[model samples]
Target chain A: MNFNATLIGQMIAFVVFVWFCMKYVWPPMMKALDERKKTIADGLAAAERGQREHELAEERARESLVEAKQQAQEIISRAEKRAAEIVEEAKADARTEGERMIAAARNELDQELNRVKEELRGQVVSIAVAGAEKVLEREVNEQTHNELLTKLAAQI
Target chain B: MASDTLTSGEYIKHHLTNLTFGQHPDGSWGFAHTGEEAAQMGFWAIHVDSMFWSVLLGFILFYIFRKAAKNAHAGVPGGLQNFCEWIVDFINDTVRGSFSGRNPLIAPLAFTIFGWIFLMNFMDLIAVDLLPWLAQLFGQHVLGVDPHHVYFKVVPTTDPNITFGLALGVFILMLYYSIKMKGVGGFFGELAFQPFPKWMFPINLILEGVALIAKPVSLALRLFGNMYAGETIFILIALMYSAGIVMAGFGGLLQLGWAIFHILIITLQAFIFMTLTVVYLDMAHQEHH
Candidate 1:
C-alpha cells in the first residue's frame, strides 16, 4: 500500500538471512546428501561382493562332492577286483589238492595189487605140490624141493 | 461487528490501511490513524505491521534452517529437518537449473526469498480480519486506543514497499554481478549498445536501459499486484459476512473457494519470483550480450 523504511528493513533482513543460510545451512546438508549417496553405493558394492563369494563357495562344495564320489567309486571297484582274485585263487588251490590226493591213492592201489599177486602165486604153487605128493604117496623129497619151490614162486 | 457502524467504503478502506507509524505535519511522530494521515507522514512513515510480520517470518526462517544445519548428518532426517531440507533442495535445484554461475550466494539468496515471500503471502490465506481484529482488541483493551484506529495488514507481499524491498535487493545483486563479471564499462556498454550498432548507441541505451530497470519494477510490481489483488478480493469477500446470515454463509463458501484458489497463486508467485531471480542473476554472470 505504501513505500517506507520497511523496504530497507526487508532488504537488510534478506542480507542477514542469505548470509546465515550460506554459512550454516546449505553446505552441511549437501555434504550429508552426497555422503548418503556414497554410503549407499558402497553398501551395494559390498552386497555384490558377498554374493559373488557365496557363489564361489557353492562351486567349491560341489567340486569337493564330485571328487569324493569318484574316490568312493574307485575304492569300491578295487575291493570288487580283489574279491574276484581271492575267489579264483581258492578254486585253483582246491583243484591242485584234489589232483595230488588222487595220484597218491593210485600209487597205493598198485602196490596193493602187486602184493596180492605174489600171495596168489605162492598159494597156487603150494596147491600143486600137495597134488604131486598125493600122487607119489611119499614125503622123502620135501626138504630137497624146498629151494625149487621157492624159486618157482619167485619166478611166478 | 463494530465495523458495521462504518459504510462499505470505510470498511474496505479500513481493511486496506496499514499500521503506519510516523510524524505528522504538526511535527508530532506517532502511529497514523487513517490512510490520509499515513500519506501525510510522508516517506518517513514506516508500516509497523509489515515490519513486524516480515521480521518475525525472517526470524522463523533463520531459526528452522539454523536448527537443520546444527543437526545435519547423513542419516534419516527428522520432521523439521526434513522440511528444511526439502526447501533447501528445491532452491538448490532451481539455482542449478537457471543459474549457471557457480556462486554459493545464489542458492541461499533464492532460498531466503522463496521462504520469506511464501510465508508472508501465506498470511493472506488467514481470514483477512483475524489479525487486524486481534490488533484492534489489544489496542482497545490493553493500550486504551480506539479499535478503529488500529490497522494491521498481515500479508507483507501485498505491500508495494516490501515487494520492492525484495526486488530491489535482487536488483542490486544483479547490478553488482553485472559489474563484477563485466567491468563497469562493460555493464554500461551492455545497456548502451545491444541489439543495435555502436553508432546507434542512444536508441540502444534507451531500449536496454528500460529493459534493465523494468526487471526490478516488473518483479516487484508483479508480486505486489497479485498479492494485493488477492488481498482486496478477500477484503471484499469479508464485507459479505456482515450483510446477512445467508450472505455470511455464501461468503464463507466463497472465502474457502478463493483460499483454495489462492494456494496456487501464492505458490506460483513465490516460484516465479525465485525463478526470475535466478535467471536474471544468470544473465548478469553471462559474457554474451
Candidate 2:
C-alpha cells in the first residue's frame, strides 16, 4: 500500500477517537470507581465505629451489674447486723423484768411472815392475862396491866 | 482483466491491491488503471478502501463506546456497560502499569488505538471474497458499473498507510510530551546526548535520531506485516479452491488451522501496539537525567 491520503484520513480518525475518548469516556468511569471506593471505605469505618460503641455499651452494662450485686450484698449484711442487735436488746429486757418480779415477790413473803409472828405474840399475852386473873380472882388496874403486857411482848 | 482470464498470481495480486484513487499517469483524476499503476502513483493517491473501512470501524467503535459512556452508572452494569467497562479497565491497567506520566490522554489514546486496530484486523477473518463479491454485485446492479472493476479491501490494518498513520500520530504525541516535560533545550539535548559523551555530539545525534525514528517505523511495520501476511494467507487459501477437489479440501484444513492461529496474532499485534505506545510515551515523560 502506498503512503498516501489514507494516512491523513487515518490520523484524523485516530485524533477524533482519542479526543472523544478523553473527553467523554475516561473521566466518568474513573470518577465512578473512585466514588465507589470512597463509599466502601466510609461504610467500613461506620461499621467499625458501631462495633466499638456496642462494646462500650456492653461494658457499661456489665459494670452496672457488678455495682448492683455489691449494693445488694451490703444491704443483706446490714439487715443481719440490725436483727442481731434487736435480739440482744430483747434478752437484756427479759432478764431485768424477771429480777424485778422476783425481788417484789420476796418482799411480799417477808411482810406476811412478820404479820403472823405479831399475831401469835398477841394471842399468847392474852392467854397469860386470863390465867393470872383466874388465880387471883380479883379486879386489877388496867393501865398497870397494859404496861406489863407491852414489856413482856418486847422481851418475847 | 476478466475474472476467468486471471491466473493464480494475478488473482492474488488483485486481491492484495487497494482501491486507489489518484492522479493517473496521463494527468487525469480517476481510479488507478492497475495495481502496478496505483503503486507507481506515489504519495498523492488515497487508498479509498482502506480509508472507508477504517473510518467505518472507527465510527462503530465510537458509537458503541459513546452509548455505553452515556448510559454508564455507578450501580450494577448490564451487558453493554459491562463490556465497555471491561475494555476501559483493561486499557487503564495497561496504561497505569506502563505509563508513569501524569497526562490524562494516554489511557484514552491507548484505548482508541487498541480498539480501532483490533476491529480493523478482525476484518481479516471474514472470507476474502465476501466483501469484494458484494461490492461487485452492488456496482453491477445498483451503480451500473463494470463488476470486475469494483475493488474493496476489507482489512484496513493490512495496509501500511493506515498503520503508519496511527504510528505517526503517536510519534507526534511522543515528541510533544518530550518537549513539554523536558523543555525545548532538554528535548534536543536528549536527542543529541546520552548513551554517548557530549564530545561525540554528532554521533549521539545520529544514533538517537535513528533510534527515535525506528520506534514509529517498527510499530507500523510490525502491525502491517502481521495483518498483511495473515490476509495474504487467506487469499492464498481462496486461490486453492480453483485447483481441484483434493486441493480444495487440503486448503480448507489449512485455512482453519491458520485462521485459528491468526486470531492470536491479531490480538497480540493490537496488544503490542498499545503497550509500545504507552512505553514510548512513558519514556518521553521521563526526566532525561
Candidate 3:
C-alpha cells in the first residue's frame, strides 16, 4: 500500500496501453461505425430516389394512356365523318340517275303518242277517200286532189 | 510470520501488505521481509505483486482488444466483435458527452483506463485466501522456500502506488493537453490567474495550484480508498470464517453478500476513475478566455 516504484511501473503500463489502443483499436472501430452510418444514409437516399422514379414512371404511363385514348377517339370520329360524307354522295348520285330515267321515259311516251295519232289519221283519210270514190263513181283532177290531201295531212 | 502464530489482527495486516522489493534498511537490495520492512524501505521500493498483477491485467486487456481489432469488420459483428464494439461505443459516447475537442487520444485513453482498471479491481473478487495460498504452496513445494515468507496481494488497485500511478498518468496528459490547447503561456497564466483575480495573482496561484494538484490526489485516493476498504472487509470476513465451523458458516454468508455488493463498488470505481480522467483532460483542453 505504500507509495513506491509501482507508481512508475503502472504509469508506464498505462501510457503504453493507451498508445496501443490509440494506434490499433480506436481508428478501425470508429471507421466501421462511420461506414455503417454512411451506408445506411446512402441506402435511404437510393430508396427515396427509386420511389420518386417509380412515381414518375407511373405518371408517364398514365399520360400516355390518356393521349392514346384521345387519338383513338379522333380516329373513330374521322371515320364516322367520312362514312357520312360517302353516304351523302351516294344518295345524290342515285337521285340524278332517277331524274334522267324519268325524263327519257316521258320523252318516249310523248313520241309513242304522236306516232299513234299519225297512224289513226292515216286510217281515217283512207276511209274517207273510199267513201268519196263510191259516191262519185268518176275520176277527179289529180293535182288539186293531191294538194288537198297534203293539207289534210298537215292539219292532222 | 507463520500462519499458526498470527492473531486475527496480524492476519489482516498480512493480507493488506504488498510483496515489496527494494533496498533494505541494512543497505542491501532485496524483497522486503515484512510490512514494516516494506514501509521502512521508503520511496524507492516496488510492490512486486501490484506491478505484476497490474501489468499482467494490462497485457491481457491489450491482447484481447488487439485480437478483436484484428478481426473487426464493417459488417454484422459476431460475439467477440460485438463485445469489443460495444465497449468502443460506450467509451466513445462517454468521451463525446464529456469532451468537446477533437483529440484522438481521449477515446482510447478512456477505454484503456476503464478496461485495465476494471480488470485490476476484478482481482478482488477471487477468494482472498485462494491466490496467496496457492503462492505459498508453490513457494513451499516448487521453490524450496518457506510458505510463511511467500506473500501475494492479488488486487492491484488496492495498492496506493498503482492507483496513484494511474492518476499520475492522467495528470501528465492533463498538463500535456493544457499546454497543447492553450499554449505554455496560457497554461501558466491559467495556473496563476483568476479564480480570484489577476491583481491577486499570488493568491490565485496558491488556490489554483492546490486545486490542480488535488485533481490527481482525489482521483488516486478515491479508487484506492474504495478498493482498500472492500479488500479489508473481505479479509475480516475470511478471518471470521477461520475462527470456527459455526462462525465459518455465518462468515460465508456474509462473504457472499459482500462480494455481490463489492462487484458494484469495483465497477463504479473503475467508471469514476475513467470518467474523471476524461473530464480532467477535457477541462485541460478547454480554452478559458
DockQ of 2: 0.48
Stretches of candidate 3 exceeding 4 Å from the true structure: A47-156, B1-4
* Interface root mean square deviation per prediction: 1.2, 1.3, 1.1
lDDT of 2 by residue, A1-156 (tens): 677888998898889889988998778777665666688889899999999999999999999999999999999899899889888888888888888898888888888887877887787777667767777886555577899888887677
Per-residue accuracy of model 3 over B50-92 as CA lDDT, tens digit each: 9999989999988888888887777778898889888989989
| lDDT digits (tens) for residues B90-156 of candidate 2 | 8998899999868899999999999999999999888788898888799789988876566788999
Q: Native contacts recovered by candidate 1, as a share?
A: 0.78
User: DockQ: which candidate is best?
Assistant: 1
Give the CAPRI rating of model 2.
Answer: acceptable
The lDDT, on a scale of 0 to 1, for candidate 2 is 0.87
Off by over 4 Å in 1: A51-156
Weakest lDDT window of 10 consecutive positions for candidate 1 chain B: B1-10
Instruction: State each model's CA lDDT, in order.
Output: 0.88, 0.87, 0.88
Candidate 3 CAPRI assessment class: medium
Interface RMSD of 3: 1.1
The DockQ score of candidate 1 comes to: 0.58
